[model samples]
Target: MRIKDAGDMTSKAQETTAAVSRQRHRGQPYVGQPMERLEDAAILTGRGRYGDDLGVKPGTLHAAIVRSPHAHAELGRIDATAALDAPGVHAVLTGADLVAWSRPFVVAVKAPMEQWALAMDRVRYVGEPVAVVVAESRALAEDALDLVRVTYRVLPPVVSIESALDEDAAILHPGVGANVVSDRRFRYGEPEAAFAAAPHRVTLTAHYPRNTCTPIECGVVIAEFLPGDEGYDVTSNFMGPFSLHAVMAMALKVPANRLRHKAPRDSGGSFGVKQAVFPYAVLMCLASRKAGAPVKWVEDRLEHLSAATSATARLSTLEAAVNAEGRILALSYDQIEDCGGYLRAPEPATFYRMHGCLTGAYDIPNLLVRNRVVMTNKTPTGLVRGFGGPQVYFALERLVQRIATQLGLDPLDVYRRNFVAADAFPYRAAAGALLDSGNYQLALTRALEDGGYDELKRRRDAARAEGRLYGIGFAAIVEPSVSNMGYITTAMPAEARKKAGPKNGAIASATVSVDLLGGVVVTIASTPAGQGHMTVCAQVVADVLGVNPADVVVNVEFDTHKDAWSVAAGNYSSRFAGAVAGTVHLAALRVRDKLARIAASQFGCTPAEVEFADGRIARHGAPEFALPFARVASNAPHWSPQQLPAGEEPGLRETVFWSPPNLEAPDENDRINTSAAYGFAFDMCGVEIDRATGRVRIDRYVT
Candidate 1:
């Protein structure tokens, strides 16, 4: 909960390699400072341009996608003749049309139920888009959708995990022969011995249902194409290159490069469902191209729930192997990943990503993750707040408590015993993910101490004596990020996936420029759906440059053509606070070097001799012999060698693209990224369950 003097590296070397730090006071004005958002002025003054805010309006028409009500079905004739002739209705198209134009492109993806931009022959999931209708107005688009009717030979939808694998079950796809849509099995360590030899082993099965992102703005995209030199320029809130791009490009039948996805300065929020909106933009752009007008489709509440992706509904079984000392030994798991219908998004990436981090922060030495990405009649499951971390964490963390109870050890003791030692650098998860960095046991100890675990348990036991039912739950999770990946809805062959790319994810680009007036502006590629990238990015610059936070400006909008950015992998995983800060900081350092060079030329001193503080540059001592940063900028430009020092460039600024290395091979035994930074938090959740009715209520929760 707090960090203090993380290993005590003094002023001579301020970087502390402390395993766990509570130095809230020390890492300030940068990492732990209480700073306001840089975009606050514009956002508060109603100048922030969200998805629907930035656009060109010129008889912009609306479009609606007609979806199949059945989970699996044989398609018949799609009668859009009436809808096409209806007043204000422009056109209607289907999966066949998309396929005919070579519009639907399914990249090398999870095989079983390969994705389709539009349902081609059979519908695999509920709300699978089968056709589209474009109309003159938003109201007209809704009314016109009812006119396009497609009859179906509906089969009973595959609904449950137990029923999905039966040989006699209705085949969702005759070509695939099964509801399974994953790649292959990936195994690492030995599991049978741990399963049989452990002093205590227990397996628990639990079902976690689908949960959607609660983004304030539902998915909306308005697209237009340019036929001349500029190409297709789509301006909307659709961002990221997930399976949606492959699906929409195929559905729209356009080159990926031709479809330029321009997200607004602000997206409402991104829990990951927004990735699906990109393909929709491509489809809308194709429709706009066909109709010779801008096509806009603003998803209403029902459409969002019925159409967009949600976190996968899963039926998971967790097994725990505990030693005599409460240390975890070996574990086995069988999870039914309900990856919905398609394999576009982070289908394989999600499962594989977590498959490696599934064991949380514990030191479990052996694990087997058996996954079956099943097809269900629901919206496709995509990334939520913690991605796949929460489900497995809830299942395993809860089971650890019960395992502790069965073994007659403190639940927290079991947790502490199983944690990777503070010195266990580059630890590995049994499944296959590689952990980069962490001081696990230290973080665990700090959390237990900070939460006052002993004191709280004493109070809880006394409360029980008073006939009050109170129990505390502790959940520990390690989430993987900066991964170059796609969704592994289930375990699959590494070679089959096309998107779980960059073996070690990437960085963002930022541009810092000093105006003639001396004020600073930094343009970053990371757009905030609300994780506060802009505010924090500027802090990295201000801290590095020794300037007031106000004097430093951070912008989220940057030209992909001019600005150096590598199509930043989405802003989920709470990655901004750590990764983004470091990225923009590197950019600031580049600019700082330039500023130092300019100062050295002007003040008859080397860059190292000139230390900038409080936005002013002075040659070490002689504080009075200084110049405001603005004055240096005001005098730099135009033919003026006589007015300035000889042999100096024009401006005092710079920009650079940042990319961090990702070379740690994960321990496939416990799903740990033996390489990334790790921190700890204390969690307490109180649940009141009715003995007679089984009604559950979370009385209180804090993390």
Candidate 2:
């Protein structure tokens, strides 16, 4: 019955999907094809230019950071005299120097907790930077680190959610007065009434441990303080959420325009860990100022693991209101996030990032959320793979399975009963997420058949009969991408947010130009950390211009001073496909339209009658009469400005700044569409537990 209702609801959406499919197949030949990445040849052959590959400058010096060994402690005198007297030592930077030279990094929450690039009078985490040594070489700097005498007075540390919340727990930030920094409660759709009237309720409490992405390359920064008022020039492999660039500039006490920041063409990989490098970038900038030379700091493996950012450790308690038919009607969430020792700039974001999709793929209409951000004696938290989705879904899916058990129904049946109806898209979720499009029921049905669900169940039953522990599982999720910049502002109270001004949209920029020699060049601010932005950009631009993908030149390097970018630019939140590529396509279209107009005028036809294909522009119905694409492109600049169309610029260049129209600021009730697009994924897996070894082995998996 549920499947039939879903099929009935999907008729209109299926028609729309078919129309879109046909439209995509019309002129986008290069886009959907499996073209190899153009960046691989250089990267795979070891010719890639990562952060460290920038090479040493004439007066380059290396830096070694000294970190606190105690989880929580009061700082005492740091005696760097011996380190300064050591061979090849240039200078030593202590917390006092940083306090005098820079300001604490700006954080999102309203709490007055101060976090500087280096620890000030107190250290709250084990790996917090206490001092930095600059020397002639990296090894010398490292050697000098041990020579610097430091004193510390150990303090009680809050290491867990319970400890952090305890009345007697030592406060990490005295100004905040408590370990919990941000807390908010949101109610949507009368969840109280739904839960009270429901026939059954299921609850789950789960913990997601702190974790980090281990990229092949860690943090690296090279900074040079220009003489006098010229300000700072810094290069780093910091794959931004470029909002931090402004934060860094503020901390460095320089105007945004004065700080010139650049990322190398290739980053080893970031996932999301590299955003934390902004703090270190500012640290090295100040180091360069003290050392009176260009300073380079390459984070060693130990430093990277010990001090670098990690995903927030989340504690989620979820309750589901269900009907006798196994349909979930409402949900209540009490979520506590451990953001480590400091409330990093984007700390509370991990809680709100997935707020819109809190209920996951279900069609639950009522939701109540109690979100809290707590601090503990651990590494600070920032973006990581799946940012907040994994933690949210972990508890949500578990609650669904528990609902099935309580109702004595099959888990799969319970899932199908609650999936958002296909025809109801663009469905607005309870928390204000606009689920754009999907056929959830059909997707799950197909996944089950393709994954051989019945066969797996039979195998599992047989193994259980033989006293072996085996199980089959399935999960469905609504994956959001192209994050709206305004969603972070939701962390603030609605009244306070009004004073802060309205924030929304994920802005991206791209530039398409035809060189004087008639070669196409594409420049984008989407910093690709090995995600193949170059390949996709080329494929997109080439399709729009009707040229071979190989002929299109795509540049993915980012420069704050040169590239047209916004605070929302840079990799994270899966923005490349929707925001970055969208801008590239728009810019390419502008260039393509210009060339088509030029060809139209030469052919004595309307611009609408012009067509581009095979590197040539011709009349739509008359392919025989065409001009080479290069000739049409070059005519505007090289030979024929007088013959150009009226009001047409005499250059083949177009720049586009794009953001999806659907993104909007949070409403008065704090409901927001946190992302521009919501994608869906369904996975089924078969696992067997090794009775003796206590390990689980995946026998089969399908997605």
In angstroms, give how far residue 126 of model 2 lies from its true place. Answer: 1.6
- Model 2 per-residue lDDT tens digits across residues 294-408: 9999999999999998998889999988899999889999999999998888768888889888988889999999999899999999998889988888888888888888889
Which one is best on lDDT?
Answer: 2
Which parts of model 1 are misplaced by more than 4 Å? 1-32, 100-102, 105-114, 228-231, 239-256, 431-469, 484-502, 515-519, 637-653, 663-675, 690-702
Model 2 scores a C-alpha lDDT of: 0.88
Question: For each candidate, how many residue pairs have backbone atoms clashing (under 3 Å)?
Answer: 50, 0
Global lDDT of each candidate: 0.65, 0.88
What shift in Å separates residue 20 of candidate 2 from its native position after superposition?
A: 28
Local accuracy of candidate 1 as per-residue lDDT tens digits, 9-79: 23212222111122223224554566555554456555667866766687878888898888788888899
Sum up the clashes in candidate 1.
Answer: 50
